[model samples]
Target: MTVSPSLSLAQRLRLWVSRPAGPPAKAVQFDRALTPWAFLVPQLAIVVIFFYWPSAQAVTSSFYLEDPFGFGATFVGLDNYADLSRSNEYRQIAGFTAFFSAVVTALALGLGLLLAVKADKVIRAAGPYKTALISVYAIAPPVAALIGMMLFDLHIGPATQFAALFGYDLRVGIDYWDTAFALIVISVWKQVPYNFIFFLSGLQSVPVSVREAALIDARSGWRRFVDVTLPLLAPTAFFLLIINVTYALFDTFGIIDVIVKDKPANNPMTLVYKVYLDGFKGNDIGGSSAQSVVLMVLVAVLTVVQFRLLERRVHYG
Candidate 1:
């Protein structure tokens, strides 16, 4: 109670020194840490507005039956989905879509890996090979489709003439199965080149020392590739696998639409094509939206499965 002024002043100074400065202990350099957000905000907004907003609209639209003008859509609950399930066309389309995606993915990946491996060995002409391969990929899908149709279509298509030269009348137009196969061929041709680029990059990224070590260990070419190269390329393969599958499902629609619009019986008319036909030709917006939702769900499930199962095995540097 009778403290000296000097002692009191010293105690006050100690308390002032102990006190936290400014606002409650903020993060160190808060402004600097958050500065990246200024740059990120525009991209984030774009993604939300264009990608997420449209996806949300598509999902929402699936539950409603829209008027012809799309101004007023009446909520239909699950009727559109129910109809899709009951329809034979939808079942056929789904089956074809699954088959086409699976076949094309496998073919593209296999061929791409092969091509990439061969190209990797070519120290002299690697650039030319890559250029030729990627050039096909750079062409517009519609243009590719048109060219594919011209090459394979029944009447005046060269594929038919080539078949004749081999004493086989390969009429793609008349034969549903042949047409389906042609679609597969076209799909594989267009995608294999694109997939090759990724595979090539992955191959190139593999350490030369590891490969040399494998060779020194008396590993044959096939064994070395199987044991070492494949393991190293697992991540790239998995990535391309998912991407190629998605492309086969979605982007290949343009080619399929061009070639098989009239031939509904052909197996190339996949789920996306069904959605397009439903929305535009059949004028069934709700049904198309439901089909799209189903396709989206399928893709989502596949993507999740890829991450869950394949991610552990992938070797990323």
Candidate 2:
């Protein structure tokens, strides 16, 4: 069927008009909106400058050697990494870091879980308990470290006084084993409060009805907790696991440094602390950059593993 000439012309005109008009065509449209980009540009620039740029520079520096003048960097092609691996100091520091991280993460998570569960069952003054528990987390790490140092320092700390009562000679300048244990203790002390907050939030977020249903089915206390409540808290548990592990690895370095600066080769010095020592103290920029890369890889792997294992178990609301 052939269209009438008038109808054909009318259709053509409609199509032509509907084909967006000039300035209106480019006018702040949703898909072409500039506001979001305008808002994002500053943040993007900051990230590029602070995070991406430095990260890129570090990666490049990892493969190079710096001359005495610091003007020219020579390509070393993984020599820094090879030297790092061969260094007994690197192995010892890494081993200490790993052991400390593992122990502190485990203790923090365990104690946090216990506290969260106990707080969740509060018959009275739960709010006070929660506030007190979480208050530790609000304290600055440096302040906390100073307090710990004051408390545990062998010469005048309360811990030394307490240990003396137990007939234990605990002098606190810097004992390798003692400092390592103190670092772990202080780490757990700081981290447990943070983890408790998350765990408590997670526990409270679990549906009351589901827990009641479990009780109706004669699932009491431990069984109900294991079978019902635990699965619900899995996502929170996984999150805290990752966060606590990362904190134990990276954030605790400052605390360790304050508590064990003189004992870098012995105490619970982490990979981050080692990197700082190499780059700033020892002037081994290449070695530090390589260690930083290794640490990034380690964290990335652990994060990926956490998601892989817990993704299926997490129940999204």
Candidate lDDT (C-alpha), each = 0.79, 0.78
Worst 10 residues of 2 by lDDT: 1-10
lDDT of prediction 1? 0.79
Q: In candidate 1, what are the lDDT values of residues 1-317, reduced to their tens digit?
A: 11221222223333555576756565664557778799899999999999999888878889999887768889999988899889987787778778888999999999999999999888478999998998998876677888988998677889888988999877665576777788888889998987799889888877888768978975578987888889888877866776777788778887887777575654458777788887898788888888888877876576556666776777765
Give each model a TM-score. 0.81, 0.84
The TM-score of predicted model 1 comes to: 0.81
**Best-fitting candidate, measured by lDDT?**
1
Q: Candidate 2 — which residues are off by over 4 angstroms?
A: 1-29, 33-36, 68-71, 262-265, 313-317
What is the lDDT, from 0 to 100, of the residue 197 in candidate 1?
90
User: TM-score of predicted model 2?
Assistant: 0.84
What is the per-residue lDDT of model 2 for residues 167-252, given as tens digits with 9 covering 90 to 100? Answer: 98775445677777778788899989887887888888777798689888754689888888888887677666666767877788
Q: Residue 317: error of model 2 in Å? A: 7.5
